[model samples]
Target: MTDNLPLAGRGCVVTGGSRGIGAAIVRLALAQGADVVFGYHSDEKRASTLVDELRAAHPDRQCSALQADVADGGEAERFATEALDRLGRLDVLVNNAGITRDALFARMRPEQWHEVIGTNLDSMYTVTRPLLMPLVKQRGGAVINITSSTGLHGVPGQTAYAAAKAGVIGFTKSLAKEIGARGVTVNAVAPGLIETDMTAAIPEDKAEFLKSLIPSHAFGSPDDVAHLVCYLASEKARYITGQVIEISGGLVL
Candidate 1:
């Protein structure tokens, strides 16, 4: 059974793993046989509940959650340190934490812009910097960053989000090149209109409009994105790096 597992014996760290796609990734990674230490921003209850559920379901695996603001370097560093301590060694790092401040560029406040940028873009640096050396030293690992289609195609009311996610793409490519020779695979996963808490807040009319843009005529489930992410983290995708894989159910917008 262990040999059949894609991530058997692997150690993983995920950011923003309390709910939504990040949570999905944490769940699936553990189900696939990895020991995981995930970070949550706030909502200790939600995070603890998730950790409890995962532990119950996978009694043989290690699962824990810690609180950290990925936007702050100090907090992120502490989270990374604690996560590494819990996992012992890291084989995969998932940068799944992000926030969206949707507003037109002209009307966007400074705080909104900065918040989105700090969480979505700066987190790539804050979280990865502390854990990257372990991967390089091992000369084998995977880094999967969660970006969004808004970054690739651009959205009308998401200027700050688009900028931050786009910056994530640039960061993924450069880092992949820098560490590829060391056998670390770095890639970005771009999700489009996944069914999560964030999308649940969309207006009925707006939701329908967004759905019409997708060739599937439906929003993808969090599991859809999780499957892609897990595949990237597995040895199956060892040769694939420095790429942005979009799982948007063929959403044009």
Candidate 2:
């Protein structure tokens, strides 16, 4: 490993890492000298392909993928156990597994609310609970949760998603204080209208309207978010904790 690399020798775990922002984090983490074990929900083919590509690219570092349903406590625990075993240690945990079940509040179904809450908010506990003790015991690590701007400013059709992500912000602050003395840093990264599968699903007219809200009038890419996440995971951000750093191009400003 290059000694000058920012995350050299760190063992990291990322959830929902097969695609989008999570995949970008995994790729950049490996490039920056971290051994990463990431979790994927359902696309085994995509996950395997990512693993193969990364392994080929970073022949010196460890890059592995495991099937995980972060919304389920049992599955999350199992994934955590296997991740720790594979890496033989843990230093960074990125909670990036989430889903969007957007609907107008009046028309939102019960299952939609539950599904959004379960996958986004509940997974925060299910995934972090098992992996947290290791970081605490080690006395140094980072926990970066991927939240959304909707969680901060709220959105009309994303009441459930916003609620869950807002809960994530609350969870992040509380946990940062709880573990700050233990040398663990916890923070949330809120992205605004990033170009991802989620944003692609937005109607073109709506997307244009949202784009106009940003000062840059352009959507951020997954790599933009990944850069911030990797920085937080590195030693440079060790002194930073319990903050929500928004990566939007001045959206809602």
TM-score for each model: 0.99, 0.99
- The per-residue C-alpha lDDT of model 2 at residue 134 equals 95
Residue 122 displacement in candidate 2 (angstroms): 0.5
Off by over 4 Å in 1: none
With a 3 Å backbone cut-off (N, CA, C), the pairs that clash in candidate 1 are none
What's the distance in Å from true for residue 245, model 2? 0.5
lDDT of each residue in 79-172, candidate 2, tens digit only: 9999999999999999999899899999999999999998999999999999999999999999999999999999998999999999999999
Candidate 1, residues 1-253: lDDT per residue as tens digits?
8768999999999999999999999999999999999999879999999999999999999999999999999999999999999999999999999998788899999999999999999999999999999999999999999999999999999999999999999999999999999999999999999999899989999999999999979999999999999999999999999999999989998
What 10-residue stretch in candidate 2 is worst by lDDT? 1-10
Q: Alpha carbon lDDT of residue 228, candidate 2?
A: 99
